[model samples]
Target: MTDNRTDPPFVADEGPMLHSWLDWQRETLAVKCARLSQDQLRLRSAEPSTMSLLGLVRHMTDVERYWFRNVLTGENTPGIYWTDRHPDGEFDLVDTASAEEAFARWQAEIANARELSSGLPLDLVGKGLRGGEEVSLRWILIHMTNEYARHNGHADLIRERIDGATGE
Candidate 1:
């Protein structure tokens, strides 16, 4: 399928085919998190979940890397998150981790992610690491978008609570 996602894939607009909705979601998440201060970006919505705005950025960094860099492009890079160590590593950061570092990481990952996402057929297929599974390029794209769509909404609410800022 041809990618025509110049606009969103809604209202039956026939301009861009929107072969990958996740593309929209990725940028949407970034837009939602944009302009937030370091502290405000790192603010949490709950004691149990450290899903801060910055955390979402970090997590999305991992997501982009996981799907685009690792799964799609088959990169051997390790995840920034760990299984047992610092579960909230995505959120809780020392002052030593400057905004430039985090932003740089995300930006670098995003550039690679966009490259990976750009050069694939929508029906492309690959085997997942678990259970001899198979996944299509379409599925991967949609799943990434779904991940961002959900978390971005969370970020919206959290940011609103932080400073009454709200929008799609």
Candidate 2:
């Protein structure tokens, strides 16, 4: 699969820098999952671990929705793959999951997140609560970039285990 990920600018303002890094991380995850079959995507890192490429995609979908829609925009949207009964459903429920659907939802959520935050200043406060305090869009962007970077590390290992493929 074509990785088409763009490098972040060497010098940029805060918003552009944050979005660029986040976009790079998102594309890195996509590259890790590229050209893999649905069954392969469902392959766990090891026994007793539910992590997988598909699971990561699903988890990020919910993460995007939580921070951008539910928290930032106060959209009252439910999670895409998580619930009270299955908090880890994103990872645990991938046995028969459709990779196409998962990717589509994830991409859609990414677009929505961009739309929701496009006009708002980075310093603008969000409705989302974290540790009993409201957060800012800038904080959410940084947090999400960090989130994807951390998860992409796991994705690197899993992808290599799946096919001996490795790289940034």
Model 2 CA lDDT for position 84? 94
What lDDT would each prediction earn against the true structure?
Answer: 0.67, 0.92
Per-residue alpha-carbon lDDT of model 2 for 1-168, expressed as tens digits?
467899999999888888888889989999999999999999999989999999999999999999998778767788889899999999999999999999999999999898888868899888867677888999999999999999999999999999999988
Model 1, 1-168: lDDT tens digits are 122234565564222234335556666666666776777777778888767777777877777777766666556677774334775566665233455566778878878766765656777774344245666767676777778889878977887888787776
- RMSD vs true structure, all candidates: 5.2, 1.1
Highest TM-score among the candidates is held by which one?
Answer: 2
- Summing lDDT over every window of 10 consecutive residues in candidate 2, give the lowest-scoring window: 69-78
Score candidate 2 by TM-score against the native.
0.96
Can you tell me which runs of candidate 1 are displaced by over 4 Å? 1-6, 9-20, 94-96, 127-131
Model 2, position 129, has a per-residue lDDT of: 75
- Predicted candidate 1, C-alpha RMSD: 5.2
Q: What are the TM-scores, per candidate, against the unseen true structure? A: 0.79, 0.96
